[model samples]
Target: MADKLKVALAIALVVAGVVGFYLLSEQALVLRVLSVLAGVAAAAAVASQSESGRRFVGFARESVTETKKVVWPSRKETVQTTGMVFAFVVVMAIFLWLTDKSLEWVMYDLILGWK
Candidate 1:
């Protein structure tokens, strides 16, 4: 029951923020932005009180930590790999083109006797 209330309150907070932003359009731009941000933060806080929300926050934190630990490839390594891939593709394309032309010549000039 309490979780449901928290979820409802969070939704209400976010909706109210959107509505307030439009309502305060005539006000200073900074004030309108701050008001909306405050409402969003409040909604997030309310949401964090729920079990699922807490779990989501924990998962996000863990994901960020794991991402930070990842070792990305250096620029030089990336360039070298890309160059190798392009070289292989060009070689394969030439080989296939030669094979196609050879087959065409054999089929038309040698076997068919048609110009």
Candidate 2:
């Protein structure tokens, strides 16, 4: 029940911020943007108090840690992979074009004799 309440409050805070931004239309752009940011920050703080929020935060941290451990491909490997993909695409395009023209020729010049 408390967690639900926290979530609801956080949502309300976000809505209030958006409303504030529109209501302060006469204000400067920076102030209006700040209003929205403040609302979002407050909502985050409120939501982070909930049980599920804590779990989400923990999961996010774990994701970041796991990402750090990943062995990403080097620049050379990336470029090579990209080049291979482009080559394959070009080859496939040429093959498809040839097949299409061949079919068109056979259908019009041979079978139907429309030419």
Candidate 3:
């Protein structure tokens, strides 16, 4: 029952937000204001739920903790890897272009007997 209520409320919030946005589309000022207002209301409603709210909080905390544990590459390593990737991409692009032009030339000049 609680889960159903939460789901229904979430759906209703989304529908309301969509409707509000559609209605406000004609008025730029109203659209901007209502957009922020609807977003805040939606957030507040989600946070108000007991079980769902606790889950959200836990999820956020776990995400932050996992992010902190990540081993980010050094600036020098990142730059070197980026350069290598770019070099490979450019080389592959040039190779493909040449192959395509050669195939086109063969088909039109030799096979089709076009000058």
lDDT of 1 by residue, 46-99 (tens): 999999789989999999999999999999999999999999999999999999
Give per-residue CA lDDT, model 3, range 1-115, as digits (tens): 7866775776677677767777777778777577757865895576557577778878999999999999999999999999999999999999999999999999999999887
Question: Model 3, stretches more than 4 Å misplaced?
Answer: 2-48
lDDT: worst 10-residue window of model 3? 43-52
Error of 2 at 78 (Å): 1.0
TM-score result, candidate 3: 0.65
Best candidate per TM-score, number? 2
The Cα local distance difference test for each model comes to 0.94, 0.97, 0.81
Q: Rank the candidates by lDDT, best first.
A: 2, 1, 3
In terms of lDDT, model 1 sits at 0.94
Q: How close is candidate 2 to the true structure, as a TM-score?
A: 0.97
What TM-score, computed on C-alpha atoms, does each candidate reach? 0.70, 0.97, 0.65
Best by lDDT: 2
Which stretches of model 2 miss by more than 4 angstroms?
none
